[model samples]
Target: MLSRIGLRSFRAVRNPVRCLTTKTTITDHTTGRVITLTDPNRPEIADYPNPKPELAQNKDPYAKYDDPQNRRNLNDPVNIDDDLYDMWSPDYYQFVSDKTALKHNAIFFSLVFGFGAIIWYFQLNPEKPAMPRSYPFGGLAKELGSGNAEDDEFYRVKPDTTAEQELGFLDGDKDISSAKESYIQQNADFIKA
Candidate 1:
């Protein structure tokens, strides 16, 4: 019975010892340093540095009644109308106000119309021929069509011949027919071989 009681107390002591053995790291804010603690019996507190004198002395430099620089002029303030009129003069501040208003108005109108123009441009039909409808494939299409007369796949695989017409190589239906004949004659070796 006594041995069992001794074992129970030993077990309790072992659990508390394990809990106390856990370690923690802490930082000291004052000196920008770190410290570690492992004791469970005492609470740990990290040391911090005190505020410096230069940082603590900062105060408002523009306080009206208490300002050191303006203290001498504080007692001489009897010209109320003159001071108020001077402060309220439209002529004194009109230049900056007018310039800013003009700038803002110009920016507002430019942005409004600029965005509308962009939206309109995007909304237009993409497939419709743009004003003068210039062709892009040019003589390559005409050459391919005439030279590959025996090979139908060449004409079918090539791009449109509209580019040659736009480039003035096909001034009329006659010119287009003649170009087709010329292409076949000039490239006979390449086409037949």
Candidate 2:
């Protein structure tokens, strides 16, 4: 093991290619400054054999376009009102605003009238009671006025009956029979002939 280790070290020292490193050099033509790099991972700078040729500069690009044609004078009067920006005109804006307002008014009024009509229709065509509202104790005023058993009968509460008759009592009649007959007539289809 000792002889092997010494022989390997000797071979590594003798073989320079195995331990070789990369080197790059750069030189500035004008400043005469030189730069040297010894990093193996760094890229090399390529040098051209010939120098770059210089290009001529043009002072005047319109040198060939020297035509002496008729030109307008700078002091000539120009038309300021070209009518190109007609959208900014007051009359046009007013017309557009009026049209927009009219459309909005039409939609608003239509919605208002439509909702009003719907409400009116519901008011006119109400949901009728499934069973006609029949109060056993004819008038609340009579019962509320006196708790007497004598005033419980029909004739005893004359004032309430008269008031009820005046305010269009059931079927606009005096008795419950007439009201029943009227209800039967109105819903004749539901009852037998």
Candidate 3:
């Protein structure tokens, strides 16, 4: 260990360091004096053996294109009527807006009529009941008013034979038959919807 430490110290003392330094001299013309400065810590800048050549400036590109024969042909200007963009002409802008409105209205009405058709289709149940709903007839009618006891038995009502007929033409009509009563009892809930 003592010999190794001695060798390390000897190697450190034997090596010589190369320091990069620069010196510059400047003159102050006004004061008529000269100054010299040195930078010891700066690293030496690498210099290229061959530097890039400077590029020449380009001339005006438009100067070569001065011939009128080389120019593009211009289109003829459009001569539109004064009313074209106004409300009067056949090719007016309002026509576009009117067409768009018509298209939207058509779509809206089609959707509404389509939905109505669907609802009407659903309302007409294929499994029609045996008895008419209105007094003149019996299976299904708009049951909007308060119905009498003689009316067709629905989802909630119990069939009553003794109930009076309120309207004039319906007064002398006979009671519902046993077959009709049984059918009504069986399909009461199905018809209500």
TM-score of each: 0.20, 0.20, 0.18
The per-candidate count of clashes, in order, stands at 1, 0, 6
**Model 3: clashing residue pairs?**
131-138, 131-139, 132-138, 132-139, 133-138, 133-139
The whole-model lDDT of each prediction reads 0.49, 0.48, 0.43
User: What is the alpha-carbon RMSD of candidate 1 to the true structure?
Assistant: 22.8
lDDT of 3 by residue, 15-110 (tens): 533332334444434343444433222223212122222211222334433333322124422222222322223431324687899999999999
Task: Write down the lDDT that model 1 would get.
Answer: 0.49
- Give one digit per residue, the lDDT tens place, for model 1 in 1-193: 5698888777665643222223454544434445554332332422222222221113244645433542313444333233333323333432468789899999999999989899798885365364333434442445456455455555544444565355444347888899999999999988974
Model 2 pairs whose backbones collide: none
Off by over 4 Å in 3: 1-96, 124-193
RMSD of each: 22.8, 25.6, 25.5
Candidate 1 or 3, higher lDDT? Answer: 1
Ranked by TM-score, the better of candidates 2 and 3 is 2
